[model samples]
Target: MLKVPDHQVAGHQAGHGHPGPLIDDSGRFYKPLQDDDRGAIEAAFYTSFSSNTRVPDHIRRFFPVFYGTKLLASDGSGQWPHLVLEDVVSGLSHPSVMDVKIGSRTWYPEASEDYIQRCFMKDRKTSSLDLGFRISGLQLYESEESGLWKPDRKLVQHLSADEVRVVLKKFVSSNSPIDPNLNPDCSFASSVYGGSSGILAQLLELKSWFEDQTIYHLNSCSVLMVYDKKKELKGESSDAKVKLIDFAHVTEGNGIIDHNFVGGTLLFDKVHLRYSYQS
Candidate 1:
């Protein structure tokens, strides 16, 4: 891609004096927490997505499934470093948006113009969420023998609208760390990612429980803001406690493509036009 200083971005290797987040003992970033296996996953992805992407051997070997939005950073040093994230707000119309509060001070640098420029705009007012541009998730478990957290059985379960709201409230209100136990029921076990499905499908599968319900769209520009966690659930230690993450997609005349696009977009436009004509 576009050649620029790495320090100004999120996930790049700035050789030295970089003050951004560092990899922990488990080989994951501490903040915006991500698993350690992401490095290689990202490298392979970059290589395939673009001819110019350079995947560092060390990073590729270290992280197997780096999820979320990646950017470059300088870390106050001259060296450019990569900023691997767990979840970052990035799509077609917006920059990689970071929600941060630095001890009462919040810093959110504008998303890269280079990255944002790459996204396809649908028209003057609308833009497509870059389908090629991706975030990360687990693909396969390291091993069942290891028995910690493997991607082998990645599944997505749907929650009712009310259940989804509860999950969102749990995530947004809590200060506790991410609990792997926070997930849907056994019904969703079948729809997890596989060789046949795309990331969007995997994400959609995760929310299949809320079918036929009106999923409220709180923020059209950013999906990250839609999920909120419960503040009270923090002190407990239970996987069944039910934490919520936002999975807002497939709106009328919106970012993603689905089977309904052709029918839905036209119908929505007609209905709107009819109403406007009447008004």
Candidate 2:
């Protein structure tokens, strides 16, 4: 929530302003949060995991762990906007990141109905993709030596080599039939989450067929780049590791598209350009 002057917003929209918690000179991010529904939600989640819908389980795996919520008092706005959350990446060793806007963008000052429809669609898709971060950061690999479209050499990923290999081995060794329609591994790899944008025409199509979900956050700037080798020093658990940071504009919806009209999907290539992937 850094003070955004009247004009410095993206596409001239105040809502599009820095969508995450504000970071001051010291790298501290102030996030506003709330959780009165936790008990009810947790009770419902226990049953949801066993359901065929599979949304709860998917959320548990890929969504950032709720380290609990905090209540805050308002100082300036005159109204008590008690919604404050601790920025997920506030204390990571080296935090750098990017986000993928799932649907279309209408960055103009006043968004049109079509743009609003697409933006809502993006929110739904994002909530589903919250599970993407859970698949394992090991599936993603970025080198420290800077290059085009490269995530920061020291950027943190959801999976590590050790973590992903275990999952990969299980999948490869499994005798069970892997459903081609629901192959999240391949689909996520081709997603903005996995960071590849080479052949999007097909990938976007694949996204529609499989790996459709939501993560809540809406802005493309919600992604974080956090890399800390010695992050867990004192009995710290992996669950607290900050994956994505912002959750300002969250929504849920199910929309279908005949073609891949995703305008501002943040592919890794768009973030960093490597020699091999560069055109």
Candidate 3:
């Protein structure tokens, strides 16, 4: 286990090397959920998704891999924010089901993806075309009464066309390569795509043909805003609220396939939103 400064010593300067009174001077303490903690978290997260049969057949193929270490120091309540793949996935999953139980219950195939199929009218009518995938988008929120973090059940809603426009516009306009939509670019997408997603924002436009709804895109982004439960507006409470996880990629150039070195897991077969457009 690696040692980091205690809470008192880690204070304001903990994340950085800045010296200040808020620095926890209690000698070196272990970073909460360091590399050693990753295995547990990964297993926990993977298991949660694996066990849940509700996950779509296509998505289950790409396993969730949690990057970085789970460093656990102490929170004031004697609890450390448990960092793990399961926690993150669970955070996105549980609240999603509670709000929108994807599949047939909420959204149907024709009502969703606008993409047209290649099969002739006769084939389309007879063939069992399974546009089976569904996306349950959710946002992580701070709990007021618990004082501990819990998924705010009310945050689920259909992605508005305007909101989608904003995310895409920001992604294309931002100077950073990292699609600020998702919290952190996945290791697979980054590893396979290339570039430092954590740094250096670059601008790119959406490749058309991908605006269909059949493909369930799950992406996250880091929230640069200040954290305040009271200030946050919920989905039901406000239509202007944004998904704080990460930025969704916006493609350009007639919306055709365009490739760039990206980070994190990109399961090209199913989840490749880079170029494949339906309809």
Ranking by TM-score: 2, 3, 1
lDDT of 2 by residue, 1-279 (tens): 453221111111113221322333343333332223422333233233324254444234333434333333334432222222234444543322233223333122234577667655544433223322222112122223321122222222233424322333222111211333432232112222233322233233333333454422133323332222222222233122213333333322234321121232323123221211221
Cα lDDT of model 1 overall?
A: 0.25
The estimated TM-scores of all candidates read 0.21, 0.34, 0.22
Query: For model 3, how does the per-residue alpha-carbon lDDT over 46-163 read when each residue is reduced to its tens digit?
Result: 3444566655544342233333333344424233433233122221211211111111122122321432232222222321112211122223232343332222222212333333
Score candidate 3 by lDDT: 0.24
Which segments of candidate 1 are over 4 A away from where they belong? 1-113, 119-134, 139-279
RMSD of each: 19.2, 14.8, 18.2
The Cα RMSD in angstroms, rounded to one decimal, for candidate 1 relative to the true structure is: 19.2
